[model samples]
Target chain A: MTVTAKIDVKNQDISESIRKLLEDILKTEIIQAILVSQHLPMKKMVMPTLVTDPDHLDGIDPLAPAFPVNAATIAARLTRKPIGEKIAAVLRPCEIRAFIELVKLNQAKRGNIILISVDCPGAFQNKDYLKFAGQNPKEATLRFYKKVMDGNAVEVEGVELATACKACEYPVSENADIQIGLYGMKTDESILVKAQTEAGDHILKQINLSATNEPAARQTAINSLITKRSSFRDEMFLKTTETTNSLEKISSFFASCVNCYNCRVACPVCYCKECVFVTDAFNHDSFQYISWAKKKGIIKMPTDTLFYHLTRLTHMSTACVGCGQCSNACPNDIPIMELFRTIAHVTQKAFDYQAGKSIEQKPPLSIFCKDEFQEVVGIND
Target chain B: MSEFEPTIVAFFCNWCTFTAADLAGTSRLSYPPNIKIIRVMCTGMVDPQYIIKAFLEGADGVLVSGCHPGDCHYINGNYKARRRIKLLKEILPQFGFDSKRLRLTWIGASDGIRLAEIMRTLVSQIKELGPSQSKLSMVI
Candidate 1:
């Protein structure tokens, strides 16, 4: 079991307290910028923010229920080539998992960044968040925290949390240097912080937080959250699988796709610089159209829509983290996340691999294992 | 009406299908003149996007002919191609294109008559289906 320590919350605001903590880190020569969640000044929306100045930490709002984007891509960009100084990045559990996948892909380096993850209480989708925040964002945030901390379901404008968040199995970050504990705790007085690594232990030691045992109440809270999430995920799997089990059904399910390719751009892990779809390779001449129409009678406009998606599935299904950003980014509102998650569930299971689970495990496709996929490869016989 | 001559794009594997196509010409066997053959090293090397591109480029239909299963010069290239093209056929109809427009067949260097037969059938099928209207070029 992991040990946790408590940080007493004085009468100070949560954002201000977090800011002070970051400021202290900046004072140390070893630390560079502190990547945190902050509310934008114009909109009361909270998103991942990178703070270089101690003074700027005042805007940090990790508690706000707005996650416009995952911070893994940001971490990937930061550590791509390296910037001399070490930085501390606060990420959600999913983001940490995503960073793990990115690192495995050689898109990110782990040498410089300190990963701090908090127990995710789940978050609302973008539009639902705006509706819930209506007129008074601060009050909404406080209410949200209260409801979640009190073990009540947090709803935004009568809508439940995003399907992805509701079904997420990992609420606590498995790969964090430092972890912020929120579930099963007294929110008004204090919250727990646990260090999972040597680096984390060093940071916690410097901060001098009072040590505490893992509270029984905290375990109960975590169990309840995980139970709820698992049930939701199972239901989601059943619902999606029932909708399309065969190739014909699957094809029909995506029949409305207009080939907009929004899902591709929305996927953070889809790091291809030049997509095959957009290249000159897909550019067809006019006469070819007439010839095909003359033969086939009618060909769908925006040809190769199915091919484009299938190709992407083959390429990225094994790495899919089920962020639901693909569905969120679609203008046509296609249920892309459902299709991807369903396929990923099957593909990943076949390889006994879950994407973004661990940095140590390499992507199955990148390695050649003679004994792997024996059933599918028909090599077992 | 003008004689219906379907414009087909044939992606022929260099070692087998491409050679078979050459054999057809050298053997003085007559076949449909609709096909415009492009040589590739292996069927596995053909990206599904290329087939889609051929359709978009005004080709009435596409024929991807490679060595028979387990007979590929590259060992398992044809098998991989089969899996990819099979998946492509399953999923392509969702985007509104007739998945039938794309055909995958295994043709050996000795099977010049089989290659000619496949082309003749493809050309006739395409002639019945008419030209593809989904080509983005037609809109502008």
Candidate 2:
């Protein structure tokens, strides 16, 4: 029922094929610009760039195993109020999911943009990526894709993919208007690009790729990848629950956090206009710290580190998409993502809701059903 | 360790729970004098941070009493409060505090006796759990 197509892998390179496809999209008069990850001229780092000229798309590489930031908020800012022409964005599964959550939070709009997503091969943390991509970023991306597609080892040398990626069960982009399929295909040959929405169908028509059928192998690849990730996710949840199961452990677990609030900054769905942490309310008087210390005789220098994280967890776990960027952004590497995700997994399941699953489904707290979570309220028949 | 009287922080919604506490005072209802009440405009106005700060400030337990689900002065404040407290309950235990330390209940403006009864029960429930190890053991 859905329109699917294939883009021939040029010169036996998946990255080249994707680049050429993006170029073709930019060439179209209908699309004004494209937002993609490209290698910076000076640094080896790859970040999201809005490319207007098709010629500049030469360095575009969305397949790289590097996620420096969650671009959902960026997309939100860009699309919050349209700037006349349409823009095509190439995002990962997590990024798309985060953007969807933003849209639900009323931070982003769904109109006047094209969402192109790919089967995520997962990513490495920023530091790990720099070490892995020593000189050639392009080749690093290709090698990473080839290994993942060939069913070879996921890591190179000693560095592996980030834990968030490994724990992620949704590898396929279910929310994108256009899904660029990599899994379940012979990537040395060609990768399938399927249109998942009416907007996707319209854009594919403009590109003029030959229509195809959904392959059986793609579903198999998706299932196996998810199964592997789900087991790891469950293991992570159990381990996190056990370790941080008590106040002492929880205090020590987040003790490294200097109350920097980097996790809040990096969170895609934490879309509050003004956070309570930054407000004057947290500005305790000089006497307050002394008073606390006088009572305890010994106290942590920077108070409320534990309190801050717990507050974030309460405010955010419901909307947490489990992208793991929080941990990635940590200077102390506090593993904030693992704790939040572990708790989020339980909270989301308790409400029978999945964050960013669809725009139609209301957030648990936003709309209340009289019958739902009745057990929580202890309502006897 | 003589009697182990639990220090409880109770958040009372102004329109209902706060009034219930006032009525209890006027009616001379006998409940454990264990709680310190802070009144907010509505239950929805009670941030989870206030509860976390209470436990951190060495309160052995927290009681969040609001208007009945449909009886909120602001229409749906209690509903929102219910959802947040229910979620907070799930997460608090994993952080080393017993989830039972936090209690959420609907007490109407006229239910002064009911409010006292619930307060009595909460104090006893926390008394049995003993003073929380995190808050008590830290205080010198």
**Residue runs of model 2 more than 4 Å from their true location after superposition:** A150-152, A371-381, B137-140
lDDT of 1 by residue, A156-217 (tens): 44867777787787888889988888788776777778889887766666665678876789
TM-score of chain B of each: 0.91, 0.94
Each model's lDDT comes to: 0.74, 0.84
lDDT of 2 by residue, B1-140 (tens): 38998899989999998999999999998899899898999989888889888887788988888888778899988788778888887788777788788888888999999888888878888898888876645521
lDDT of 1 by residue, B1-140 (tens): 88766778888999998998888889888788888999999988887667756755567778888987778898877766765565455444434446667788878998888778777777878788776644333321
Q: Which candidate ranks first by TM-score, i.e. highest?
A: 2
Candidates, DockQ: 0.09, 0.51
What RMSD value applies to candidate 2?
2.0
Q: After aligning candidate 2 to the native by TM-score, how far in Å is the CA of A367 from where it should be? A: 1.9
Model 1 per-residue lDDT at A263: 86
lDDT of 2 by residue, A99-151 (tens): 88888888899886789998897899999999999899898888787777633
Sliding window of 10 residues with minimal summed lDDT for model 2 chain A: A372-381
